[model samples]
Target: MESLFSTMIVLLLVSLSCFTSSEALKSNKGNITIKWDLISWTPDGYVATVTAYNYQKQRSIPSPGWTMSWSWTSKEVIWSIVGAQTTEQGDCSMYNENMPHSCSSKPTLVDLLPSTPFNQQIANCCKGGVLKPGLESAFQIAVGNAGDSVKTVRMPVNFMFTAPKQQYVCGPTKNVRPTRFITADKRRVTRALMTWNITCVFHKAT
Candidate 1:
């Protein structure tokens, strides 16, 4: 009777362990994941091209649905937004050949004032649509042209992502208005950020 009781207790413990393991798997099923990559960076006034990939099997996710802010400082030069492009496919047609081929607006080269924090809404940046999984999307920001002055600076950018509130089954031609993306609760959204610096060197012909 003692041996039989011991075996019964062991079986009960094993069953409980399996139940906990199954719960863990169920909780993580069909969850969305985000992957970021610094695709390319050129010191031509430090153009940083970054890419974001959705790793889930479902539909794409919305970006900066909550908040995205960046700031910078430089002693001798000012940072500007010369050109930018955001799309679901990682295409560089607009940013190639040292010219903006397909941007909606011309290169503005807006200045980034010293010690001043800037938000996406104030910058008037275009809002990107849903980015499908297995396919990647990219954002490219070009600063001012490289000059003779030697300078090194860091630009810190932070943003969040969330599922879109409105669901539409339509073609890619749907234009996403920037106003559609209002600032959301930070506590409820997913957050990520990156900071990269650039050092400019001016070389003179001998």
Candidate 2:
């Protein structure tokens, strides 16, 4: 009886360890949204691209219960890193280049600024493009030159957001007549959360 009880206790501890590896505690449940940043996926040597995707997690037993991952519309997100572990978010920016990083886990986000300054920062993110989302619409700029063909690129999160207020340039001086995107109930996200993974898909226009 003693040996059996010890074995049960060991099994219970192992089960708990696996469960905690990925934050699935009821208190840790948080909603996450995903959007793509086109040209901006400029990590080194990365190629192929993600067109569309939806995130899903294991809903049953193996106990990744609260864990999840995304399925992309295109298989373009994968890449080959000659010999390095991906060190940053945009490390996998190209279609045929090797992806140095993996999204199999949560994205690394220490670079993300808080809502206020980031909104203000967006005013200067893009130099040559026009944003279509109105003030409601935001744009992402790739770190790579639009014309670079054989180099690897990595995207930075700042590529996904801008601060609503103008400290630098790029902030609009006039209210846009029509907003680019409005929520189902007609509300646009606040300038605060506006950049939370704000996606600006790419169009290689010729």
Candidate 3:
């Protein structure tokens, strides 16, 4: 009887341990994810769209909104951007004409205001960085100096995202299946050349 009781206790402990481990794994899954899609090939490099999605059920990114920064793997430059803008246009003095938007290897970007001109806006953009639960914001960037083809282009690294009062831990970029887009008329379908994703989880700042 004594041996049987000991065995039962051990089984209960093992079951509890497994339950706790499963909960921990679920909690570690992030609430925010950022996706980068190479939509088109530009003469110099490529045009990509970066989108941040808020998956939290109750939380929302309030005004004075989110900011994202990432380091380029190579000497990539932002030729132009729509739906968002860099906080600083690093030194563009090297270009005599057709000035690049940002020259910094690590560029910080913020969403455009709602008052931004129509020509400067894109769908689901210019939201002032306020993201309600289940909503997403996106911006398009034309990158120069980076490779133009899938075999040559490089992915950015070390992405960092900041919300009004919250901090997030971003994961490394991962190559994912290309994204497909359908026209408004639903008559045509197109797909991105390549796609990558960076998932970030909300961690209360210590």
Kindly list the per-residue Cα lDDT of model 1 for residues 1-206, writing each as its tens digit.
99999999999999987665445334422322222222223454444443334444654444432111222233212232322322222233545455432232122122122223434322322334344555544345544432222243333322223344522111111111111123466445322223332111111111
**Which of the predicted structures, 1 or 2, would earn the higher lDDT when compared with the native?**
1
Candidate 2, lDDT over the whole model: 0.27
**Looking at model 2, which ten-residue stretch has the lowest summed lDDT?**
58-67
Error of 3 at 68 (Å): 0.6
Q: Best-fitting candidate, measured by TM-score?
A: 3
Task: Assess each prediction's global lDDT (C-alpha) against the native.
Answer: 0.33, 0.27, 0.89
RMSD in angstroms, candidate 1? 20.6
Cα lDDT tens digits, model 3, 21-133, are: 44533554447889999988988899999999998787788899999999998889999999999999998898999999999999999999999999999989999999999
Reference-based TM-score, model 1? 0.31
Question: Which portions of model 3 show Cα errors greater than 4 Å?
Answer: 1-30
Superposed Cα deviation of residue 197, candidate 1 (Å) = 14
Clashing pairs for model 3 are none
Candidate 2 residue 87 Cα shift, in angstroms, is 12
> Model 2, 122-161: lDDT tens per residue?
4322221222222121223222222223232322332221
